[model samples]
Target chain A: MLAESLALSALLFTIGVVGVLTRRNAIILFMCVELMLNAVNLSFVALSKVHGVGGQVFVIFVMTVAAAEAAVGLAIIIAIFRHRQSVNLEDINLLKG
Target chain B: MTFDLLNPVQLSSALLPDLLLVAGAILLMLMAAWRPDSDARQRTVGFASIGLLVLTMGLVVWMAVSGLTASDKGVIAVDGFRWMVDLVVLLGAIGTIALAIEHNVRDGIVQAESHVLVLFATSGMMILAGARDLMVVFLGIEIMSVAVYVLAGLNRRSARSAEASLKYFLLGAFATGFLLYGIALVYGATGQTQIVEIGNAIRRFDLTNDPMLLVGIGLMLIGMGFKVAAAPFHMWAPDVYDGSPTPISAFMAATVKAAAFATFMRIWYEAFYNMFSGWAPSVWWLAVVTMVVGNVVALSQKNIKRMLAYSSIVHSGYLLVAVTAASALASTAFTFYVVAYTLATFGAFAVVASMQQLGETDARISDYEGLWHVRPWLATAMAVYLLALLGFPVFGGVGFFAKWYLIQAALAAPAGLTILAVILVLTSVISAGYYLQVVRVMFMKPRPEGAPEPLPVGSLTRAVLAVTVVLILGLGLFPSRLVEMTQMNAFPRYPFSPALQMGQPQFRR
Candidate 1:
């Protein structure tokens, strides 16, 4: 059960990483990041069965921080969307080197 | 006396500076919201934030001088290392707010909450400086990064600022995922979240070669690599620094980097000291790559902000050299180097802020051509700052000694990083290519015929420049005093030694 859960968590994390790299929409990219965080949360919860409650406690912290990150992330996306009518990453190129 | 954090009194005492800053930040946040947002309100909040930072710095110094220490099981460190880093972070925060008060008015950023956010971010940095557990480290990084993410976009009027915020937020969050996963895996491998306990577990269980632990460390390195803007993982820094308002850029470049590096040093030195052979080579390569990429790319940048961003990346590379050293002296060197770098970075950005005309964001290197003819004082101070960043001797001031100690630490490391030290020198010479180009433009190039005179330096900014310049030069001339201070506060060599862990004085006066 532990092995299977770890494998599932790793798979979800990989999917999230790929989505972040491949997606060009700003909102999608953020969602992918949230997906990655949740994947880690899954790993922590799964690991807590063997490692005691520390992993479970870490999961709570991760969730709270992820929520905070989401709030700030969405506010930033909204600010950018107000300027350019699009939420596409490619269109957000005013700061190129 | 050793602090047992389970005792509420001891925990509060151990966390006095962090608590004071957070509590002050909350009050200031209320003050910020109480006012109808205006330039006056922003200035008031900014000054109040500075005062709060100064007060916190006083507490940190008191703690350091009084020789507080925490038990090995404690979640927070109460040592000279934490106090020194807290001082650096607080000083950088004070300078950032001072510059912001003036810069925000020019950029039309009237939100008083911006100053409050700096306080919140700084409190997070203080948490980072002392965090001895992985969970605390995660919380501190998130706290610092989230506030900075908002601060990066504080100039709502500018699309570039918004873009910077988005890029920083996305990349920062992605990096946090890697960091958190690494923590989870490490926790799984060693069954401990406390860094000191992890070290003990590895030794007691002989888990040094455990694949799970190895992978966990690698992922944590990658995550930290991104935070410190080390190469290959540093894609987001240039754009973010260029687009953020100048003072915010300075804050990000100096204080934010200092806090992240402090936590990075602590975790590696304290938790993974037993696994030195496994991680040193990876860090060595990181230092080398970061140095080459930062200097070479900086040479071709036309925009001054982008150039400075690249330059900051290069400094991160230099600090990484100290990380690779992984010695008690390396931590001392790191602390000294961070102080000099913060001063020079803030001073340079202040000059950059003052050079801007109202509402204009463009700052080309060409604009600096012949600035000496019109603003001789500004030009000269810029020279001092640039030379310092270049690590040139004497005139570069404390920057010279900063590199000197770093090289000393690298050479004296147990691994004997001779080749890395040599590369460090070669890269310093390479860095001179860009740092001197700016100086050459100011001193040698004639003023453009139609150029307008640069605006007079604001009173607060002028004070910042004067203080940084004096310290840089003063410390440059008398570096021994600073060196002695760093030596006294150096990260303990044997972190787990019972004598040192028992709150005894580790260094002689």
Candidate 2:
């Protein structure tokens, strides 16, 4: 069971990385990041069978941090949207050197 | 088994500065939220936040003095090392708060929120520097980063600042993903998150060949590399550093790097000491690439902030050299080098802050020309710092000695870090090319016509510059004292020293 879940988690994480790499929209990029975090959460829960409560406790922290990151990331996306009238990463090149 | 747990009182005392900072942050946050946004009220809140940072520094100093090495809760490690880093973080926070409030007043932004954020961020840094558990490390990083994400966008009026904030948040979150996955994989491999326990597990299982564990370690290294803006993972640093407020740039470049390096060293030295063969070579390559890229790219930058950003990346490479050496002596040199770099970097940024007009940073390198003609004292102070950054002899007391200490640490390692040391020296010379260009522009180039009048320097910024110049010279000339202090505080002492190579057991066979 643990091996199966770990494999699933790895697959999901790879998908998330692909989404982040290929996506241009800021909102989707953040969603992909969240996907990656949740993928790790799955691994933690599955591994907890052997690791005991430490893995579970860490999952909680990861979930909470993900929540906070989402809130902040969304706010920043909105701020950028207002400025450029878009949240596409392509349009946000005002700072590139 | 020595990990203490369930002692609330001892834990609170162990966390004295953290308690004060949390209380102060909450107090300031409440005041900022409830009070009307007015200049006087903002000033009051800003000054109060600076006062809080001072109190935290005083308490950390007292703890360091009185010998507070309590490690309750199984997650904290309050030692001389963590205390020293806390003091640096606090000093950095104070300078940043001073810059934040002053910049806000000039830009008409209410600064109370920035003060609160800085206090919270510093508390997070202390926790990070002291963390003994991987879980605690993750929490500390999240705390520090969430605050910084907000602080980056605080200048919502400027579209560029907003873009910087958005970009930082996106990439930062991506990095956090890498870190979380690494922790998960490590936990899966060892079933342990506590540093000492993980070390024991590795030995008991002879887990060096465990592919899962090796991959986990690599991922964690990548995650941390991104945080410190090391080569190949440093795409976000220039934009983030240039777009954020200058004071925060100074803070991030100085204390954030310091805290991240501290944690990186602790995790590797304490938990993975026996696995140096697997990891050291990768870090060596990172050092080479970071040094080459950082210095070479910096030579082409016209914006002074961007130039400094790249310069910081090069300094990160030097510090990474210290980490790769991974000896008690190396850790000590790392600490002393951090102090010198923080003082010098902050001092340079403070002088840059004086060049601000109406809240925007006019950081074109040419703007520095004829600076000596108008503000000789400020220009001279900047030169001292630039010289220190360049690691020039005679004038660069701390910088020179700091590099010397780093080389000694590299040479002390049983493995051949000699080449890394040689590369570090060559990069220092390459770094001088851009660093000296700045000095030349400031002292020798003629200020072009239509040059803006010199902005007024606040008494507070002036004081930071004065202290930095003096400290750079002091640390350079009398480095023995500071080096001795680090010698006492250094962690993961001789048992796990890189010279021992505890993993291989037969090096020359």
lDDT of 1 by residue, B1-509 (tens): 77898798999988988999999999999999996999988888888999899999998889898887787778888888888999999998999999999998778999999999999999899999999999999999999999999999998999999999999999999998888888888999999999888877877787868989988999999999999999989999999998899999999999999999999998888887766767887888999999999999999999999999999999999999999887778888999999999999989988999998888787899999999889999999999999999888999999999999999998887678889999999999999999999999999999999887887789999999999999999999999999988888877535444223323211111
Candidate 2's residue-wise lDDT over B134-236, tens digit each?
9989989989989988888887888878887887888888888898898888888999998777877887787878889888999898989889999888888
**Model 1: residues >4 Å from true position, as ranges?**
B493-509
Candidate 2 residues lying further than 4 Å off, grouped into runs, are B1-6, B71-73, B492-509
Positional deviation of residue A80's Cα in model 2 after best superposition, in angstroms: 0.8
Best by lDDT: 1
lDDT score of residue B354 within candidate 2: 78
The alpha-carbon lDDT assigned to residue B91 of candidate 2 equals 89
Which lDDT value does model 1 have at B21?
A: 92
Q: For the second chain of model 1, what is the TM-score against the true structure's chain B?
A: 0.97
DockQ of 1: 0.91
Candidate 2 residue B342 C-alpha distance from true site, Å: 0.8
